[model samples]
Target: MASASRDEFHLIVPNESQSAEVKLGSDVTIPCHLSPEISAVDMEIRWFKETDCACLYKKKEVIEGRSYQGRTGLSTEELNKGNVSLNLREFKESDMGVYLCQVISEDRTEEIIIEVEERKDSDGQPVNQSSKIQGRQVHLILHESNRTWGENQRMKMEESALMTEFEVNYVKVLHQTIFKVFKNQGKKLEQTELQLKESKTDLERVLQQLETITEKFGLLENKKDLDMKEPQMQQIEKQLLQITKYTEEKQNQLEEKDTQLENMSKQISEKEKLLESTIKEMETSKQQLEALRQEQMRQQELLEKKEQLRISELNEKSKYLEETKSLLEEREGKIKSLEKEKDRLNEELQDKDKRLKDINAKLIQTVREVEKKQNQLQGKHTQLENMHKMLSEKMRRPENKELEASQPDEQETKSKLEK
Candidate 1:
């Protein structure tokens, strides 16, 4: 059965409701809770990356492991308070994956996943070079990269070739189409003008006929002076009266036709106005279409520029990668050489250490000998002092006896001489 320590703690991460997506370089906090009261203060905290399933932090220190050595950071203060959130600085696209925070307690172990995302630059550009969009403002900077500039130049040449071909084809087709349409419109306008002129001529002829009838009526009225018999005169007068009536009726009919002609003329004028307006509208539409085409051409040019920039950037990156690989290989070789030198130095150090130990032992032995010699010298000095004292005492005693004898002798001689 699993130990209770393995089931006492739980790890929690932010859900979708809490955050939609977390961007790179942004601080993130993960929450963990211990159930049944955590008592094992010695429990170890570990953070593992899911991409490689490698430990990033362990035992309150960053692991000297492969890729996470310099890239991972964590807050010790937060960890003490059961906050084992890890902060990755300068977040990379590779960091955009799941991470696991593991806590090993006496009774339980818990883990949680954290997702990292690529950060965007101030201009809303992705940090990953592959995901960056080419901007007009960045063109000059991108062109500075030799590879990108070269690719851009090549692409420009290719696009110029293609555009030239397309322009030739498009212009030829457009010219033909426009010429045909203009010719047809011109023919239609000419036909309408001819019809209008014919209508006007017919109207003029009708007016002339009405005028002639009026002249005839005037002649009949004037002829009233030349009379014959009453019946004959009455018949001529009736005929003249009929002729006048017919001329009046004809005049009314001509007036109606003139009105009709005027209406037709007005309609034609209105149609001409409409046609002019339509032609203006068509001109406007053509202008707009031309503008749109020009804009599209500009956009294509921009796209080509972007592609060139991308190709150049890729080449530069490849070169940089190559250089980095070479540097890394050199560093690896240096590290191996240093390792060997370190081993050699360690051996030399061990030999020096042994020599030093021997030297220290000899020094200690010499010190003991000097101490013994000092003690012997102290004992000999004490003995010599005692012997000299004895000798002094003996010499003083003999001298005193000799002086007393001399004095006694001198005194006896003086006594004898006095007697």
Candidate 2:
């Protein structure tokens, strides 16, 4: 159902309108991205070669369709920006075919098709293209097929990069916000502590003043007893009353300062608890990021192995191509020899035809000469029959004997003229 929905965004192939051509035994990336360029970090990217699923990215990890494995990948950094291109590490003969890229989101799913074609031969023709050898069709095989193996290394790289990026950014922002809160609270607490210290100093000064005043009042009492005067006694009593009232007020001020100190301590304790929780959360995030980094490193090692395997494969392929080249050269020589043989056979047929034409012409001339002789014989036979008829007529009429001799001479002359 999501596949059919095209509500707000749609996937598109940006490079070409119809298809893309990638060389055999080479790398290629089929570009597909979103129309409005929204983040695709949370979306699923799936690639298929015709009906077979070549790669699947769902639930933030790869699963099933290990067909392409190490040689294929998608860019996580790009995926975050909605570019879900499929990369092919090494293209093979079987790799040249139609491929589909599917992107599924929470609200919509879209797919696009790309046709990857094998690179043409050095002669600008496909290696599978039929060739003519001695006027017969011959299909040539020119390249060697070699492949590498591993888990989907490309996907691993992208996943490690993108996933880690998101986590790091999240943790950093959280750290900054918490630090700001702590800084403000700390400033407030420091100010309160300073005020409490000032209040303690003021209370100590008040106690010292009260002790000095009491000592002076005792001296006045001794002086009043010795002088025994009314004015002196009244002055001492008024001074005592003022001193008592001032001391009581100082005591109340000290109690208020004590209350303020206690409250400040409680507030500091609450902030400390919050700071501890935030630090623990940051540590947890660090642990997760570290795990992803380790996974990325492992994937990197696999990639190195894949590269080594590819190098060995390339060497084998080079050797295979050399062997194929030698075979083609041998076939070329054979084809050339067969062409020479065909030419020789054609020349012989031409000569035989010419001789047959000459023989037929001579036979026709001889038949014409024989036909001329047969015509002469037929005229002589007619003349002889006419002569016999004249002789019989002469016998019937003895008186016409001289006329018959003349008729016989006429027949003989007529026969000679016919000849």
Candidate 3:
């Protein structure tokens, strides 16, 4: 036989129904400890009002409500010693409750209730109001002469009115607090009533069990009845023996079925392993195919870009070729016109050369004629000089003067007439 084992976790509260009282505005500590006095450093401790389940402390942290904020604490030192007690500061009448100190360890949970009561003052009046008034310290002072005494009196009256207003508000707060306490009490009472009902039912069941036990003991005391039931007891024993055999047979069948199931499970695991390997292979192949597709798409895009570039280059070349053809045609037409102009100029140059040659021959002929005229004028000037010299020689002869004189008159007359 296999014995079940579990962690031994337990809590010990000195008094399960511990009750403590403190005056209003006073601090109080509710105690709880571990059963084995073991470290509860890792345990969760919850301090909540059992009535309303309002949590006040939890797991090294305080879940402070509106009235509990800055007023609840758990000492770390005590927690290490397994003391999951809660220290409540500034108690109020509304804080009165059956608070639960729950210690939750690894495998076990334990809880205890701590009844905290609100202690009253010496006059049997609630101490909450006394503390509130003392803490407020409401004071009014006046410094005025008799002339302003009337005004001071009015101010004093106003101060009294303000105090009364504050008092009324405080009364309202007290009433509300009382109402909340009653409401919590009513809830707690309802829970207690339910618990009582459950207890009554359990007690009735226990009483019925006691009655059945007593009737069985009375039947066992009669020897005559036991003797009369001997055959029936034997028959019951035989039937029990048959049931035991049947149960043994069923157990054997179940064992066989369990063995078969184990074998089938092993086979299923092997199939699952093979399937996983196949799936991994398929995933790798899919990844490779995806990569190939991506590469193909990239190549297709490159080809498209190259084709577009080539088309653009071809268009540019065609445009350049067309321009070059047009320029060649224009150059050919200019060459033909230049060739014709050159032929016409060559003919004009030949005709001008012939005209200059004719002018040169005419000038040479005119120069020869001028030279002949100059020679004829020189001969005429020399003949005139010879005739003057002959006349002078004849005038110098004296012997022949008479004959020359008579001729001289005629010569002189002739010479004078000639001169």
Q: Pick by lDDT: which candidate is best? A: 2
lDDT of 1: 0.55
TM-score of each: 0.27, 0.29, 0.27
Please give the distance, in angstroms, between residue 7's alpha carbon in candidate 3 and its true position after superposition. Answer: 80
- Range of the 10 consecutive residues with the lowest summed lDDT in candidate 2: 137-146
Q: Where does model 1 exceed 4 Å of error?
A: 1-254, 359-419
Worst 10 residues of 1 by lDDT: 136-145
Candidate numbers sorted by lDDT from highest down:
2, 3, 1
Give a tens-digit lDDT track for model 2, residues 1-419. Answer: 12332356777767444333434456767667787777777788877665556666666665334356577777777766777777777656566666667777776767666666544568987654544222322222212112222355434434443543444455566567667766765676676566656656655666666557657666566766446544554665565555556555555655665665567556656656765676567557756866786788889889998998998899899889999999999999999998999889889888878888887887787788778877877777686777768666665776567575667677776777666
For candidate 1, the TM-score is 0.27
Q: Which has the higher lDDT value, candidate number 1 or candidate number 3?
A: 3
* Alpha-carbon shift of residue 231 in model 2 (angstroms): 4.4
| lDDT, each prediction | 0.55, 0.63, 0.57
Off by over 4 Å in 2: 1-234, 291-341, 362-419
lDDT of 3: 0.57
Clashing pairs in 2: 25-91
